[model samples]
Target: MNASLLRRHRGFSLVELMVSVVIGLLALLFATRLIVSGEKNKDAAVGGSDSMQNGMLALFSLSSDATAAGWGLNDPMVAGCDTSFSDASGYALPAMPRAGASITPLAPVVIQSNGANPDLISFNSGTSQAGAGSIKLFADYTVGNTLTVDSKNPYGFNNGDVMVIAPLTPGSGKCTLFQLSGFGPPPNSTILVNSGGAYRFNAIAGLPNPYKQNLAYIYNLGSPTLMHFHTWTVSNGVLLLRATELAGAEAAGVSVTDNVVSIKAQYGFDARPPGPNPYDPTPGADGMQITAWSGTMIDADSDGVAGSPGDYQRIAAVRIAVVARSKNAEKPNSAGLCTATPVAPTVFASSAPAGVAAVPVQVNVAVAGDTVSWQCYRYRVFETIVQIRNAQWRP
Candidate 1:
């Protein structure tokens, strides 16, 4: 009776056991697939958020600096002159080829375009306590001599103040940078620019040219350390800033943000003045109304020359677009291609003003030496139109 009972209660047969094992394996596989899908979705959401944050930051930084451009250098005599600068400490402005000369314009903002790549924009301003005021030279300023000014008004010049000696007329000559060492003798009418002795801006030789009296004026640029001369660019999927004040003559670039692939910009030009007087030749005649948008400065007044000082003066605002990419690349399909981003992003999507030709901006996503194809990554574009308040305030 015991033997018969034991046989009846025998464990599951081999076929039944195999079927149970198969069911367990199938359940385990389904759970793993579900977890993997959830993780992928989480990654996508996080990456999108990160790209948005980074893009906003880059736009803000660029806008803030660009808005402050030409603060101390806004005077007509200094704003658009091709400036000649030298820093014994190794600081120098990158020159752009204009007309038949290589010049660094003293305009509020200067944009350098890189076809199919990111553009480089530079912002220059001053932190003068005395404001953007100029003092005419009382006498001819020879090399190694002092700059004589009106004794009645000192213009609030202090020792170590960086000064720019610009031509009385724009485009006549190149502006030069110097430092005010101190007042000369008594009456304190003369400003000294002696080289050496803690003055890094002053060249040992002297001014590049002897500025004639009344033909040139001296504009105070305040302390060298407080000036704002910055250049912004995108490189290797990152935004960078090269500041002359912070880096001295080194002109070394500091990383600003990550995953920034490109920066596209255009000058908002007040080409035509208000109706009833469309041919006004006076600067800022349009009352800051943007009549045209262009990647390069145009001859707004029909002056027969592009990129002239007057053209630069008509730059009332700047429009910029910054592109940011996701932190992690999406997985490729079995065919070894990713469909994360089907097409390249577009900038300045809106229709341009009437009669204005639109310049299409082509964004290059295939970064050289990148392991993953550009199609594997997703991108976002942040754009803003920032008015140059300083330029608007000009006459």
Candidate 2:
């Protein structure tokens, strides 16, 4: 009984204790490694999910704007039409393309710097309000500078509002874009269309002989209210969607979304014959097939003339690509991984127009001063084709 008690009370030997400690340490290390790997994978999944969400939102916003392009504005007439207008506030709105005009109605779809940096898209639409919202001829003043509206006119335009004036005569396509300078309050009504200085309605460049017409229709293109011109651009890692009148003050830009690294757009032109309507050129049975996908701007209507209105009239669809990156960095920054800029696919129609490049593009842009490598992060690519509803037909 004494010998048995001695053996039971005995502690482990030095060698046996060391082997037991080693086994315990190995098990602990294995568990820790497993946990770390799981956490890393979880992070990667969450980052990928965030990028997908960002990409979808950005694409939706872009699609909505592209669909609305060219709404309300009719096929412009070259006989006696003008595209330039300004208001008393010094905000210049040009319906036609100018050297640096931020808003251009002639080219309803404008893409800038397609592959390099983030591309800029400027889409234009007209206001769609009728009855009280519609333009009415109240009093045709001889001065041509001021026009009086009926007290019942409910449009209630404010200063710096962009307005479109069109002749209501049959077969008349004469229209002009102007800015509302001042207006009299409610009961008594006078709309000051121009406030001196190059702000007059005639500033529209080309007006037919015998300009003053009684039956004129006016459409209010909102200043900062309803968006008339949409400019999508990226600044400092943020995607901004600015909604304002072409004649609005510079203070009206609003940020739309974030985490959008870049946006690429290609113009889809349909060069088929005229539709049921001889003058209205429509995309043929092949479904407005893409003739050319331009990284820059393409003349929608080519009447074999330069700077003509025909270009904007033929645009049927737009193919857009939006790229998003994870907001968080998961791994250490390195020289090899996230340094190359993805090139825009030069191929058109087959797969490039669909936003798939002939070659798979891996964009791992390194952020300056970032400790984590961009390659250690996740990315998503979103692409969609938007057909301009208003641009489907020409007057």
Candidate 3:
């Protein structure tokens, strides 16, 4: 009887058990919410910081490059009018290029620059073209015929081919191209190839440039709008992009990943009014002319031509816009991808109205050293416009 009765006090009473369970449940509930809240906050912070760092890096470099966009050491060396571009025939040299020809490529362009130059600047030896020169000087040009490519030379070339002109030496001749500004392709490149050579992008759009095309640089290391960088291709049904590695890698370009879902970009242009109300309506036009560039100038949709030339020319600036999301959204069971809730809210700076935001930031590539020296800084939109206009400086 003693042993049996001893077991009676060993078990928990009903009221005591209920109380213990309630206390435990409450603590667990609180702890779970705390952990989830902390994780959400951390994700938010990381996303915001990453966005900022990437934005600044991209903005600074593009700005500086644009600033020094067309700088060339020679009076008429071609620095950025689509260097190394070939016609539909695959030969980059165009038989004839008028002022208003289609500069926009329907597909990836195959072009290269070898810095070949005309031996002399012919002047008064005239045919009577008004723009023709009469004095003798070293001729520098945006265009030229290919000189011979000798295996023994830096410019290993065949005798009757074409090449962009550059100096035989780095900083010497008007006969050669020099970097007045420091962005885009080398002002005078004999040979520039990408890391994979021709292995990075869609096979159909392959080209020989190191980064597909010069200064065809992209954001987020060439994720979205990479079409802006070089070319796009499909190999065995897989989509890929080719990028020149700055250095060190076995085909170092990246493939699509889960964390980054979609990337879209828009170039920012300033639409200023001659006065302030550039948007006011005129008699015939939908609206009156304005100085500030608006969406009308942007080929964000990539229809090729800019809708407005005055506005396009005035595109004194550009900003890049991107959309990124977690790859988890692509999963079927995941809560609908378009959640009303944003794990991380983005912060942006804009000058437009309350509802509109401007993502493009300015860069000033202008500097005393090389025009490319501009890639390290930023500028106001119009300031960039001024620089673009100044690209016509001769001598």
Top lDDT: which candidate number? 1
Q: State in Å the error of residue 386, model 1.
A: 0.5
Per-model TM-score on C-alpha atoms: 0.90, 0.68, 0.38
Q: Model 2 Cα displacement at 188 (Å)?
A: 17
Better structure of 2 and 3 per lDDT = 2
Off by over 4 Å in 2: 1-10, 78-105, 130-144, 147-161, 165-176, 180-192, 196-224, 245-252, 272-289, 304-307, 333-371
lDDT of each: 0.79, 0.57, 0.27
* Candidate 1: tens digits of C-alpha lDDT, residues 1-395: 69778867997779899999999999999999899888878878888988999999999999998888878776767777888787765766757666766788877888887767898888888888766867888788776757777663476788888889898778788898888888888766788887887688887536776777789888888888888888888879988888767753246688989999999888888877433533334444336666788777677756777777777778888888899988888888889889999889888766455565556676886666889989888899998888888855552
Model 2: how large is the Cα RMSD against the reference?
7.0
Let me know the TM-score candidate 2 reaches against the reference structure. 0.68
Question: Candidate 2: lDDT over CA atoms?
Answer: 0.57
User: How big is the positional error of residue 165 in model 2, measured in Å on the Cα after superposition?
Assistant: 5.7
Candidate 2 structure quality by residue, lDDT tens digits, 1-395: 69878876897778899999999999999999899889877877887888888989998999888887766554443211334443333433333332243333434676665445567787777664431144465765445556666544445565766566655542244456666677656666666654445443435322222224456656665553454666787665567765554343323456667777777676666555545644444444444555555554444444453233444555667877777877665754354554222343222234645543432233324445656645555667788778875655444
- Which regions of candidate 1 deviate over 4 angstroms? 1-8, 247-250, 273-286, 352-358
Give Cα distance to truth, residue 77, candidate 3, Å.
9.7
Instruction: Sort by TM-score, best first.
Output: 1, 2, 3
